[model samples]
Target: MAATKGSLSINSENIFPIIKKWLYSDHDIFFRELISNGCDAITKLKKLSLIGEYEFKDDEESELKVQVIANAKDKTLTFIDNGIGMTAEEIDEYINQIAFSGAEAFLEQYKDKTNEDQIIGHFGLGFYSAFMVADRVTIESLSYKEGSKAVKWECENGLEFSMDDCDKTDRGTKITLYLNDDSLEFANEFKAREIIHKYCSFMPVEIFLSNPNAEPEYDTIPESEVTDKDTVIETIVEEAKTEEKENEDGTKEVVEVSPATTKAKILKRPKSISNPVPLWTKHPNECTEEEYRQFYHEVFMDYKEPLFWIHLNMDYPFNLKGILYFPKINTEFESVEGVIKLYNNQVFIADNIKEVIPEFLMVLKGVIDCPDLPLNVSRSALQNDGFVKKISDYITKKVADKLSGMCKTDKENYEKYWDDISPFIKYGCLKDEKFCEKMSDYVLFKNIDDKFLTFKECLEKNKEAHENTIFYTTDPVQQSQYINMYRNENIDVVILKDAIDQPFITQLEQKNENVKFVRIDAELTNTFKEEVNEDELKEMTDKLTEAFKKALNRDTLDVKVEKMKDSSISSMITLSEESRRMQDMMKMYGMAGMDPSMFGGAGETLVLNSNNNLVKYIIDNPEGENTDLICKQLYDLAMISHTPLNPESMTAFIERSNKILEIITK
Candidate 1:
């Protein structure tokens, strides 16, 4: 055929620029798009071979693969695939026409005869992505059909193209990209390798990256080390090494301990950079614990071992296979951005796509490959479709099922991983209602005794002490005083230290209306108080409150006097649960500037133990010389126990403590 030139067939004159802007914001994605087109070509050829429509010549390359070559000296990046190529007419029909997909056409023609699970390109715009980074693009292709002639096509600025017959005799296709000034970095060998590793690490076909301008690197290996998938450049022999050794009984002998010594051959083995088959594609029974760990490490590059993993494999309703790893995260769950890589037919689409991955699952490291994903034109995001919701719901159900199953069958390991995995489960509960319902029974709480128990177990165990009330401590060390009081009464208190626990407990309370979560310092229940005459107790409280108010010099201070069974306790602080929750909600919503006391009397009440010696002395000598110092010291001590004391208050307490020490010494 003679050389022919024409403009690209498209409706809009500025389509190319629109494609450059809208197809993908990341220009480097052109690498993924072009390579995906190559994979699709190979997949089409494989379908043809399977149905006997095409035959591979004995001398041709049998193993299908994609090769990427970066030539820095020429400022060009090339992609070569030894799969089905295109004819002249086919190129005109597919390449000349914008938004026309060759892969989709081939699949339609062979719809009944072939399985289209491995086809990666569906949008038909993948080939045009090359224009995003290249100044010019060229295509050289020779079809697999017999008697087909090789064709060459070139396009510059994506507006006009020229086609002609070429002398090249390659069986497949070769695409060369002339890197633009801004995209010159893609031509660097290291940069090319990095891009390929990012997108093609789990492609169905093996992908190899090379630098043609650099010196060829050769490695020597034995002949037996070469597999059918390896490419051998040359073979060489190995010299044998013989050493004389003494036997155990004192006899000296020369033995051939090295098996391949005399007959070994050095063979060159070329390795691909990608794994054609990832761990998720296999059946769960065929995988081991070590293999799961290895796959997690390889994909996530996280050295900390995962707590556990859920292998999702379903064929009916929709084909979805994945491995969701519960990573051992070091930071807060809200701040964590878990890497849940989404894939379509083993081709990476994006990470943490909320349309296909439940919002809560984003805090997990895993891979989900659904060949039936409904991707938009760019193949970068999911189209608004109901199918995507089914996938997300399926993943959420699978995770909830796995956790509940583990709690039922493997109680020990479930408890062992509960601390690290609780935040994730709690987050899921807060975000997803169905997941919360499914995981409600499996939630574990760690008590002050360092033992784990479920909500039901906690309620049942503490029914006699505080019915339907779950008392928890936020800071175990700082709240140890109140914890000891509860411990003295044999009342159980669970630890809820994480910020997530605030909303989580609230959710639990809403779900189970009868259940309540109270902070340990929220109230001094009757269980901790001694039975005394009401009139006498009321008179004592009135006198003590007046005396404390006069000494502390604060007229607005909330004071409560209680005769406690623990006489050693002098004073403590208590805040109403409603007031504290309101304050916490305000802070959570970023309204820290608002006065929390406006919602309720959020200011804590100073609880004075009437049985303590200090309270007795203060009530007896309200106007004594040292009464003011002792009352202020007791109030500071209570403040320190409730929360950290302010710097100024701490200094005053230190000075008052020294004065008391001086009085004691005198």
Candidate 2:
């Protein structure tokens, strides 16, 4: 048949130029697109064979394979495939019309919602991507139909392409791209090999590239001289004697011995390269821990085994599969990097998927495979795909479930990792409401005694002692002295040290009724209600306030007296929790124009007991130097308990201590 004489009409005259210049950011993607198209054609042919629509040749080795050949001398790169080749008419219909998508039509016709293995390229322009790196492209193909004549199609920069019948017998397509001057690198063997390995290593079809420098294996045989004499030896002397005795009766049976030929040993050839199988596609139960560890090392190059792992497999709403490994994180939290890698169809999409998982969970290391991601034409394109939200939610739930399971089965191990993992979970709860709801049950709180307890357990244990209050301290070391005082009084205090603790506690306070977090050194008054009579408490407070003002010069100490529970004996200085927390924030932010003296300078209220002997002595002799010294010493001790004091104040306190020691020695 004569070549069809018809001109192709494009949506726009500049369409080809736009595609060549802007459709793909990377010129190397042209090879991936072309090879992907070849794989799709092969898949179509296999489907046709399976359905009995076409008769496949009865060849022992008929598997589909893609071959990439680089001819630097000819300045052409050829991509060949054993797929269902198109005829002259089919070429005129598909190749001539660039935008006509055969994949789109196939999907619309089949529409198997459950099958996710369908080919990815839906647009027919994948072939045209070659123009990005080629000045001219030619296609030679022979149809699968018997006696189908071969055809060739050629296209340059412009739309004026020529088609003609060609003399070819191969039953597949061979696309040869003439490299442009600037794109000659694609014709280099090394460069082409690299590009193929990066984009097509995981492709279903086997890809072959010419390796001229590869060494060949050979077998060795020992040299031997041949002897001309033909001799026959028999080892039948004993056997023939027994047979002769039996032959007297039988008279017919005779034994004959034959010599067997021996061949030389042959050596097996060594395998060159082994292809790595994608483990992300396999079922979790079928994989062993060792296999998972090996796969992790292959993908991440981390020799150390993971601490734990979660295999995520979900199909509803969206398709997702991956194994998330929690690597051994021993270094500072800030040093952890490149935790999660995103993959689509067993191909790595990106290593930094910080947006996919919550920022707090950034320490988690693993891969996430979601086939529904709307990758841009470049396959490198990442959009705010609607499916990403669902994927994120699913991952968050899985992580929460794993953590909850650990807490239930291995409490000690969970506690060991709690400090390191708490920051992430806290941040997740603070930022993601849904994640918080799922993770709240597993959040562990450590009390002052070094015991780990869940929030509900802590609340239950302290219900009676800490009525209408949830006391928590930010700095355990700074406030440890107060813990002893509270413990002595049978009050429970939780240690909350993270930077986010203050804000988180505040949020929890608002959410929970009649419950609030108060710093250990926040106030002189006890968190629990006082058992002393109101009249007696008022009398003691007035006397202690007057005596304290006289002992420490009234101008230096802005001290207010309040009666605390009898269990909290003598006296203690306290700063309001909110005020102290704000000061910490101000210091962190380095807010300028703020008065430094205002911070650490606020007057602490001093609650004293009139019944205590120290209080009685200070009140009876307020004008004495002994009273003044004791007042300064007590205040300094209180400051030391909350935070380190200035050098000047510390020196004064030390000097006073020495003087008291000298008096005792004398």
Candidate 3:
């Protein structure tokens, strides 16, 4: 190889500026890109060794790794890897070209002989990400070819780069970045180490950090100080009780005292930031509960333990390995983007990427490493290609399978976590039809009676009476009267309190034919039985409607009288299910810039109980403030029970109550 100079193959002269300012969202990602490229080169060497195409020296036979060297004085950061180095021709083809992929080109050249997925990097833009932090980058590499000379390549954030033979005779690649003034932080040993630990915590290769003139701190003490066997003592205390009763958490502690438990173990802390063998790389049977929890906290930085996790491992359809955790919902992170760290192999790419992760699943915190992820040059977003769709579908299916499996094997445990996980399930059903179909059976509801039942159980339990209808309540407090009324009739009402549930019900009904979910307060279900005939009810309704009109002065008010079994209640506000949905939609989007209270405009239905003694009394004395007071109170009671009262209505109710109190006292 001889000295040569050439301009990079790029269309725009401002490519480096675009890469620095807009290519990657975070500036710290330059280290990840550069280091991952080094890892890719190492993997290529391993693959070639396994295929018997290349022989490795005795030193190359050991474990392969990536090392980071940061020199603050020189303001330079370097990445070194024990992997396949590039020849002069290879550098001209791969480095000079901007978007061309060297690994992909190699795979095509050795299509019949090599495994295509062994390579970790696909985009050539990784090397240029260095320009985001540095003004100039240099590469010194010696190819594994029999009589190869060391080659050096240098470019100062521009298309013109020089490649020449160097004095270096190493068999691997070394990438050195001369830090720019703005990115001098990367040259700091502490900053570079922190960035490496954050992004390369679980990379497949062993990554060691080194700083010049650094003092070595030793945690490996003398063998005499270390104990070969350590005993842990345990104590137990029993609380005596008269009878075994379940706690609110659904667990009961029995009063029984046994021997103290003891265990032996060696105590040692982790030495490296990266786990060479990650949880996802191992089989589910081999994984322990403690290991899963450890990984969860380490990756998400979530302090609380996860409710459960799904281990995804598939090699055939596409190599996908991951651990998706169902974090306790309603945490401080409910509004934050979840920590679903996406990866290519073990190298992290991004978090909460919609193309790789289903939008609903993005609510979860986990890691998904798939070499098959079709990433673009920047490696920030997924490419609009077909294989990425398969990866997304596979993840959705795996999650549905996990939820369904847990329900079948452990009903008690499934219900224990239903409240926290229901929102995720409902959102998944609303967003994905395939997920809806898979999760429809496992979709659960907690009735007001504190019973957990799936969709089928709910339907079967209420089928004879409610008939293909599932009555639910969005606000337990506001709908308590209706809930109590339903309970008196031995009717069960499911609680749908999550904000997403309003739209989720529509999807559920569309998926399950002939099944409908109506809000308990929105309509009167068949649980209420009316005895009075239509003619008798209409005549009484006509009299009561006329007397109440003047008291409740709204001219367009629609009030229907019904003869109910419960005569204690005079009136209950009823809105059609259709109207309630319309109101919710309008309120969510806008009510024509008007106050949301106008949603009760023409859709408000006040169903008065004709069987109530108060209605009969009002109709008989239908002429004075005595009748007006009772009518107003009845209407106000219904208004408060149905929804929160507007300020105007609340003030009026207070004044009327005071007037009634004064009159009674006089």
Each candidate's TM vs. the true structure? 0.93, 0.71, 0.81
Q: For residues 1-666, could you state the per-residue lDDT of candidate 3 as single tens digits?
A: 557777778645325444577668888998888888887888788888888979876665665788899998899999998788888889888888776678888788778887766476776677888888888889999988788888999998755799999988778899999999999988888898788877887777778787775664334333334443322232233333354667889999664344333333233422455676789989999999999999898777889889999999899878998899999866444563467988777877888888888999888999988888788766778889988888889999999999999999999999999888888888888889899888888888888988888888888877888788888888889888888888888777899887888788887687679999888877765458576677887787777888778888867677888777888878889987877787778778766445345555446778888778888788678885599899999899998889999999899999999998999999
TM-score of 3: 0.81
Error of 1 at 50 (Å): 1.2
Error of 2 at 244 (Å): 45
Q: lDDT per prediction?
A: 0.87, 0.70, 0.81
lDDT string, candidate 1, 1-666, tens digits:
888999988735325444555668788888888888888888888788778887777845447899998998999999999889999999998899887788889889988997778888876788888988887999999998889999999999788899999987878899999988888999998998888888888888888888767775666666776667556776666555568999999999987755543222333345799998899999999999999999999988888899999999999899999999998877753357789998888888898998998888898999999999989777788889998898899999999999999999999999999988898899999999999999999999999999999999989877997899999999999899999999999999999998899999998898888899999999999999987788887887787777778877778778888889988999999988887888788888898678777766476899999889998888888778888888888888888888898788888889889999999999
Instruction: Give the Cα-based TM-score of candidate 1 against the true structure.
Output: 0.93
Alpha-carbon RMSD to native, per candidate: 2.9, 10.0, 10.4
TM-score of 2: 0.71
lDDT of 1: 0.87
Task: Note the residue pairs that clash in candidate 2.
Answer: none
Candidate 2 local lDDT, 1-666, one digit each (tens):
666555666645225443577767677878788877777677667766766767776661255677788877788899888887888878876777766666666566556532336365755677878888888889999988777999988888635688889987888899999989999988887898878766666565667775333343334332121122212222222222223234656767545553333322233232212132466677888889898898788767787777778898887888888888877765554465546777666554556665566666666777777778877545665677767777787888898888889988998889988876776778778878887888788888888888888877877877886666667777777776777777877777788887778777776777678777778788655453456677866665566566666766575554544434453345666777766766767778986346445765453556454555666677676666677777777777767777788999889999999987887799
Which pairs of residues collide in model 3? none
A best-first ranking of the candidates according to their lDDT comes to 1, 3, 2
Model 1, residue 624: distance off in Å is: 3.1
